[model samples]
Target: MTSIKPGRAPSFLGGIGSAFAVIFGIFWTAMAFSITRHSPFGGVSIIFPLFGILFIIMGVVNAVYNFRQATQKNRYSVLDITDSETEPDPLNERFGPIIEGHVFETHQGDVEFEAHDDGTRDNRRPRFCPYCGDDLGEDFRFCPSCGKRLPE
Candidate 1:
């Protein structure tokens, strides 16, 4: 398998789309004015509707493509609560052991944090480690390699 690096959205495509949107607005306004049979904006009146339509189509296509790029499999959007447990639930009391790791999932993948903690001398903050909970160092807020935020 191949790994993909996270990168920012392409600015070129956005610039082009934004340009089209602006042109679309201009053409739409001109066309509306022309259909009113009032050529107030001057000479470009003849192709107003044509430009308007072209711009609209291009702009829509660009938007769709950008949306798709933004939602790709490797992109991380937010955290999800995968599994939880409560030793016992009492009225007005919270459920579960302090808190456990989340079964993180992304569009293209999933990551599991195991509790690999020895639970004795780990000076790290409260977090989940694969075997027990001893593997994670407290210096970082999120997993340094995978970017998973340590559960509070």
Candidate 2:
């Protein structure tokens, strides 16, 4: 829908999935809830709802994670890419090859996708550059982060 800024990570989805997990989980659990007291799992009578809530929380967490990833910032190219260039075909581009932002990935996947997202509250601030995990300094011109030159 929107252009992804190069050198950026997708938006951090915060507590978004929490809503979904709670909703669907509740729905499924709710069905069992009514039947529990009437059915087999009704010994305590409220356990069904308790589990439902847990599921809902799970769903919400899942959704938030997904959304966060989708919205996360992306590697920003130096030039503007028209829809025609990217839409018709990704490989075909008017601007010559451009360097995108850096990515700090792990075995699981990228944690600090963009250089700026590095923060204590947001992420653990991996020992390496947030974008590339490479060693760098505060004054380094290129991204010790990803070895890419910082935009002027």
Candidate 3:
């Protein structure tokens, strides 16, 4: 099995590039506005401001996207695959003692036996109700949620 390693967050270089773009956009827009106000160029001057606005919008979007990525807890978009097949399942690792034929104790200090057993203490209960996709206990003769007869 292939194991995937967590990847690095969005680089600071990207943020720097975005900042440069926004600065250039602001400068370009200011220059365009000043030129249009003084010169007799008329409607043609509108194109410069529009291009500047486009650059500003693109830069802001890129910055915001990078900021969100940087703030995320799991920045694992880029995965490094490795040939490590012996990794344990996370669920099993968490509930190993309870799942290994041991009685589980509730928060209220009540111990509950495995519900899904066929008299020999082996957990043979169906995990889910096929009809409605609801979770099922081991002793269920029918789906409680969907009221469908379960397979024997």
CA displacement after TM-score superposition, residue 3 of candidate 2 (Å): 22
Among all windows of 10 consecutive residues in model 2, the one with the lowest summed lDDT is 90-99
TM of each candidate vs. truth:
0.30, 0.31, 0.42
lDDT against true structure, model 1: 0.50
Predicted candidate 1 versus true structure: per-residue lDDT over 53-133, tens digit per residue: 767677767666565556566553333333223122342133422234433322222233334355333333345443234
Candidates' lDDT values, in order?
Answer: 0.50, 0.50, 0.63
Better of 2 and 3 by TM-score: 3
Q: Model 2: residues >4 Å from true position, as ranges?
A: 1-23, 38-43, 74-152
Candidates sorted by lDDT, best first: 3, 1, 2
All models, RMSD in angstroms: 14.3, 17.4, 15.6
Best by TM-score: 3
Cα lDDT of model 3 by residue, 1-152, tens digit: 33353333434466667888999999989988877775567776787788889999999997776665566666535454321123434554465425645544333333335644444454454467644679988788889897977655
lDDT of 2 by residue, 65-146 (tens): 6555556555333455333323343342333222243432333233434344333233333344433447765566677544
Give the worst 10-residue stretch by lDDT in candidate 3: 80-89
**Alpha carbon lDDT at 140, candidate 3:** 88
